[model samples]
Target: MTISLRSRHRWFSALQQLAQSIPYPLRGLLLGLLLWSTLTSAWINPDPVWQAFAPESAIAALGKLLFNGTLWPHIGASLQRVAVGLLAAIAVGVPVGLLFGLVPMIERSASGALQFIRMISPLSWMPIAVMAFGIGDLPVYFLLAIAAVWPILLSTSSGTAAVNHKLLLLARSLCATRSETIRRIVIPAIVPQILVGVRLAIGTIWIVLVPAEMLGVSSGLGYFILDTRDRIAYNELTAVLLAIGIIGCALDWSLQFLQKYWQPSR
Candidate 1:
């Protein structure tokens, strides 16, 4: 018993020390990495990553042409797909989450089905998406939805199920209706978990977007990557790659910021 107690105490002490040692400015460090990737790439001779940095003035001119000039249209197309898919997922996920979370019968019925679908790869659905939706925006959006939805749905369900029993008891003591209990007691308690799911889904969809966009879409960073490859515009390719990374990191940071502000106790 003494040995077990000593081990447990040591483990907790280590965790507390590690957590406390984390730098306050870690977020700033991560942001700086995204912003400075363009400046820190290794020399790959004959590649644009090096050539693109010609003169600062020349680099600025080219980057301006690439991003402000040609990139916006691509960005817009990608955003459209991402927005539609993510919105659809949220719509579908939140309600399903509520059902499974609030209704044990629903949860029991879904156990195997949810596990099966979640286990299936979103990329594996590519053939099906293409066959059903064909080669345009529909396929792209389909891919995004498949890639992103499960995390949100699963997390929301878990959050709903795990809501503080004390809060529920308090609501009952106040004679709260089921709807009122869910709205007032449950929603606030679960929002943080739901936000985490949102963050996870965003990460999933963002990573998938480029490859999905490369599906012969005229505009999107995915297309831009393909176009650069075919044109041997390696510098342009690298720049777009950098842009995607920076944008994804920024999106995640934004989500984190929202999570922190929305739940200070978290």
Candidate 2:
């Protein structure tokens, strides 16, 4: 038993050391290569998803058109919708999270309804949102807000509830006001956990951004993809697919950077 325990300890230590040693940019490059390989594999042999890597000139020309000619409009439109929806979700979710997590009775009251509602996908809300909010940006915003809200809410609540009992007592002993204790002690202590939720929310937003843009939105990566396919510009489509992936990865990387900075002190 002692030998087995020691071996496990050594193994865990080695893994920790290795994880710390791996540089972020190299890791990102490797991940990008993996993504490219997976996506282009069929094309290497003649697959529909990939027509060809093709000539650099043709690909470059198509890419140039995609960038300056038509793609920008679509991308801009989608980004705006994603930004608006996510910000709205954060506005609503964080406050609700604080309420539930701090008040057990409130949490209990909300638990059943929240769980039931969350099981329904944001996409599932599409028909209703479209009807209620109308065809354009509203529907897209509705979907994104639905998709991103849950993680932030759950994380904030958990973080707030998980506040150290000793810290709570310390605050009490200091005769801190309710608002002051929450502002200083609770918010700071829970920030790391909340940051984790924010990271998750960013990832979800990225994935849903295109899909959300699909709901009759005139511009965005999703709209561009559909338009490219409709025009049968397969190579350009592939390039744009690659570009979208790159953008998504960059967004995730930025979130990770922010998360590291946002990490709460123990």
Runs off by more than 4 Å, candidate 1: 1-62, 66-68, 264-266
Provide TM-scores for the models: 0.76, 0.79
Candidate 1 accuracy as TM-score = 0.76
Question: lDDT tens digits, residues 1-266, model 1?
Answer: 99999999999999999867878777576566544554544443455556553334334544775656787787777778888999988988888898899897989998898899889988888889999999889998988998888989989899999988888899999999999998887878889888999999999999899888877688888998899889877666766776787678888999999888896244
Model 1 residue 72 lDDT?
74
The digit string of per-residue lDDT tens for model 2 on 32-140 reads 7666666566645465545354334235745786667666666677668777887988998888999988898999987999999999877888889888998788888
Supply every candidate's count of residue pairs whose N, Cα or C atoms clash at under 3 angstroms: 1, 2
- Candidate 2 matches the true fold with a TM-score of 0.79
